[model samples]
Target chain A: MISKSVAQFVRSLHQKKYRQQEGCFLVEGAKSVQEVLSSTFEVDLLLTTDAFYKENADGADRQRCRIETATAEELTRVGTLESNNAALAVVRMRANVPLLRAPDAWVLVLDDIRDPGNLGTILRIADWYGIDTILCSETTADVYNPKVISASKGSFTRVNWWYGDLTGVLNQANAPVYGAFLDGDDVHQSPFNAAGGYIVMGNEANGIGPNITPFVTQRITIPRYGDAESLNVGIATAVILDNLRRVQG
Target chain B: MISKSVAQFVRSLHQKKYRQQEGCFLVEGAKSVQEVLSSTFEVDLLLTTDAFYKENADGADRQRCRIETATAEELTRVGTLESNNAALAVVRMRANVPLLRAPDAWVLVLDDIRDPGNLGTILRIADWYGIDTILCSETTADVYNPKVISASKGSFTRVNWWYGDLTGVLNQANAPVYGAFLDGDDVHQSPFNAAGGYIVMGNEANGIGPNITPFVTQRITIPRYGDAESLNVGIATAVILDNLRRVQG
Candidate 1:
């Protein structure tokens, strides 16, 4: 059973301020919890239902991560998920943002991606396409937002994110800076060299902001052939990334 | 100004059962409202703030839909959206399911897409790729759900959907069925004939259900290069469609 103080401490992590202040954020569900355990992230606390640990005994033993028991009701209180997932954890948030100068490959630079799910999906897309860095403008939703953490399916561990001025970072990106827009060049037929660069995705309602738009070297778009006015930002990101990766003479 | 009874009526549409019972659904924001008004879907009412109407008079005129003026406060009370978008409309649900024939053009068959955003993205994807017909399983999220409607960004008008037994519909799609799965053939190298067949997407947690699994004639997946476990379903759909469209050679 979770004590009142423990529950209070866990719930506080829901806020961006609280998560930053403590240098810890929460991840829930068996998949994410297990991924964190196996990855480089340090687990502050490991809370799981007894039934969950028993079923995956071998994986649990190899993890050697801390184990704490919770009844079904206790699991219900701590988990940020809509339903009571099998496990939840308080993992230390990486404190520093790595510099963007050394880009061996692509990094995603998001300009105010407000939706947590979209931001997370972008991170996952970056992971799938071998892009290892994510630089978020201050206006972007907090990376540690639980919904993003869950949507990423633990790709957050592999990708490094820095929250700062997008203009400053674009200046640092020596290679081409590509932006997704309505009238941009067709991504399907565009020439995207794979040396290294930043792929900028913009706000859901608005495309890339005027502040960073000037720095963009290539304006590209996933061409729409049907009647929908716009594709969801996440889908557009994947379409663009997938196409960019497959570009070959 | 909305009367007490009118406010109560508007608020009720927030629920799926209520939207179903009244045979009407809500659309918000300038673009979505305009799209619904312009489409064959009937508009029961259009609610807006005064400022919105003045600024968007041209769009409103083009739509020529009915109108109602309300304070922003009144909109919040009746709206399902968290954002205070300029307009909202109650559109008559087009319960008309298009004829269930094997589409000669590409069609997306969703076995059990649960996320409103994913379903909406899929709807938008269908629009981007010109796949107009989407057949949903009974378990999929209602396309009329405000999130799904909002996420489609007005693509809902172009895409026709039917919620029924998925396999039955797949039976009609005798040409070919491409199912997305982890163990499927690499979509990059696969020959996905565009001779009007079905491309099936699975549930978020579980892929195609057992009932629908057997109906898939070909299983194809977007090959992943990173440690990320999988791609988001909507992203998978876009990637697959984009590749298939490219691999048409």
Candidate 2:
């Protein structure tokens, strides 16, 4: 049984300001909660159904976090998901540490990508392409947003992200910076960096910001065959990464 | 000024049953309303701001639909979009007629794409790849769903779709049927049909339904380099279409 205060605390994390004040965010549903239990991130508290608790008690105990058994209805009421039958974890956020680019490995950079769903999907796409590190401009959606966490499908645990001023990082870049643009070298024909580099994606409505555009060493376009105005940024990312992997292989 | 009855009628189209019973769907936002006005699809009614009505009065006149000048707030109140400042169109639903495959052009088949947003994004992707025809399973989300219309941008105007039994269509397919699967020929290395054929995408959670699996002449897989359990249906669709276009070229 969950106390009134604990339930309210969990509910409060739904808002960004509360999450920031608490330095914790929610990971809902069975799969994501299970994933967070195994990851290195600290879980402050976990509220779960009896069945979930029984199946995952060992993992939950290892996290050294307080665990409370609650009804599925109770779990759903406190969580962001429509119907979370299994679990929800209030996990602590990681520090805004700088991530170094690994040798011969691609790094994804986000410039003011404001949508939470898009950000989360991009994280999952990055995980699919084995791009582990991501750099985000401060204007990008908060990594700790529950929508982002849910959409990532637990990929948030595997991928590392750093949010800061993108211009400073791009200006001092030692490797090539590739940006997605409407009029640029065709991604299918353009040769990518053999040693890997920074791949920057911009805002949903606007392309890359003016501050970062000058730092791009290469501009790439996904050729359009039909009359659609533009591709969804997450879809564009996946296509670009798929092509990148194909050429690298 | 919009009347109360008209507002009630527009709001009712948000549900599928109402849309079917009335044989009309809502097209919200400035761009989509404009596109639907210009498309062959008939517009039954149009609610627009005075500013929008002035800008596109000729096109609105050409649609031969009843035009009501309403405030942006009124449009927003009755529409699915949070802020529809320009226009909202009540469009007549097209007949569920069969679409013939254009020779040497690919056709997309969806088994049970349940998410309205995913369905809309797929339509956009199909438009981007020049795949104009789509066949949908009965269980698929209704194409006229407001979320689908909004997510599709304006691609819903360009792409043609038919909803019916997958079994009948696949049994009579004249060309190769390519189904996306987990274990199959690597899409990158696989030789595609020189002449375009049917490319089938399945349900979001379930890859391909058993009913449609047997009809697939060739099973294709997008090779995953990292740890994502599966790609989102829309992302998968884009990736597959991109590869198909690249190889065909």
Candidate 3:
């Protein structure tokens, strides 16, 4: 049972400003809620349907988090995901930890990716490709946005994201830097090292920003077979990672 | 110069029912509106700002279509794209022409792509990869949806889409059938013919439907390097097409 004040607080967390002030963000839908329950993210509150509660009540973390049963209608009203009938969790935002670049694993650097959905999808792609760390420019979409959280499909729990000056971070990184371009060396034939490196994906409408350009040691292009002015950034990231994995494997 | 009746009609096209009833769909934003003007699609109406009118009024097709001046506010209110400030064109739905499966060109078969954005992104991927025709199951999202058009980023004009039974179309196609699966042959090492074939992409959550399963002669999988449970359907399509092009090129 949700009190009026608790309901208002949960609803407030939907907006980034409120989330920043409260130091927490929402994780909607069953998959993501379950993922956070098992991850290092500390859950402040869990509003869910009785069925979801029944299914997860035995988990060890249940003792540490506050749980409340919510009707489907209440969940829809409070959560950004209208179709979510399972749960929504208020997760405390951990301090921004510096991304640790593993010598043998690739790290994704995002340059001003604005769309929440694209950012979220990119996280999932990173998670799938075993790339653990993502460095986002300060202008990139907030990862805590409900849209991003929903789109990441629980992969957010596994991937570490740090937001700051991308140019500064990439410049200091230990590995080789590869940037995607329209007229660069074809990714299929490009020299890719099995020792992982940094792959920088640019903004949706704009390619890599001007500041980050000088840091790219190698320029790569995904050859286009037909006339699409460009590929969507999220799709491009996944395609690049897939190619990267092919070479590494 | 926008008429009350015209505004009501344009607003109604946002719904699939009205689009189907009117036998037309909207081409919103400057890029898509321009593409439709140059394409074979018959434009029934064009609502635009004065700047757009001055820019495009010289086109030969201008004589064949009705043109009206609309404020940015009006365009935002009537069109599905809220950010659109340039123009919107109401294009007649051309009859579903039989897919011209060029024997040496690949074709995409969508099993049950339900998201309009995913479907649109897939179309752009198809357009980029030179896959000219797409056979979609009746359950697939309508190609004429504004979200699909917006996401396609003008690729809608280059591609031909047909809605029908998946089983019937695959059984009738002259090319070999390839299905994407988790346990199928690794796409990296899979034998791909330079001659065009039908590549089947399944539903977002359900993968391929059972009814369409029997027609796939070859099963191919994109090997996972990370633990992401599955790639989004749109990402999967682009990745598969990229690999196919690698072999075909």
Q: Tens digits of per-residue lDDT for model 3 on B93-134? A: 978766767868888999999999999999999999988889
* lDDT (10s digit) by residue, model 1, range A1-249: 777877888899989999989999998888887787777887787778888778666655666666777776676676678766588888898876655646457778899999998888888888888788788999998889999998899898898888988898788678999999877888878557568678899998898999999999998977666666677788888888878766631
Sort all candidates by TM-score, best to worst.
Answer: 2, 3, 1
Interface RMSD, candidate 1?
2.4
Q: Individual DockQ of the candidates?
A: 0.62, 0.83, 0.88
Native-vs-model 3 lDDT?
A: 0.88
Off by over 4 Å in 3: A60-63, B60-63
Judged by DockQ cut-offs, the docking class of candidate 1 is: medium
User: Candidate 3 docking: what grade?
Assistant: high
Which residue pairs clash in candidate 2?
A: none
Candidate 1's TM-score reads: 0.92
lDDT of 3 by residue, A208-235 (tens): 9999999999899999999888999999
Ranking by lDDT: 2, 3, 1
Q: What range of 10 consecutive residues in model 2 chain B has the weakest lDDT sum?
A: B182-191
Cα lDDT tens digits for candidate 1, B84-190:
55788888887756545454678788988999988988898888887888889889999999999988889998888988877767776668888888888887675
Comparing 1 and 3 by DockQ, which wins?
3
Candidate 1 positional error at A53, Å: 3.6
**TM-score per candidate:** 0.92, 0.99, 0.97
Which stretches in model 1 have alpha-carbon errors above 4 Å?
A55-67, A100-104, B55-66, B98-103, B247-249
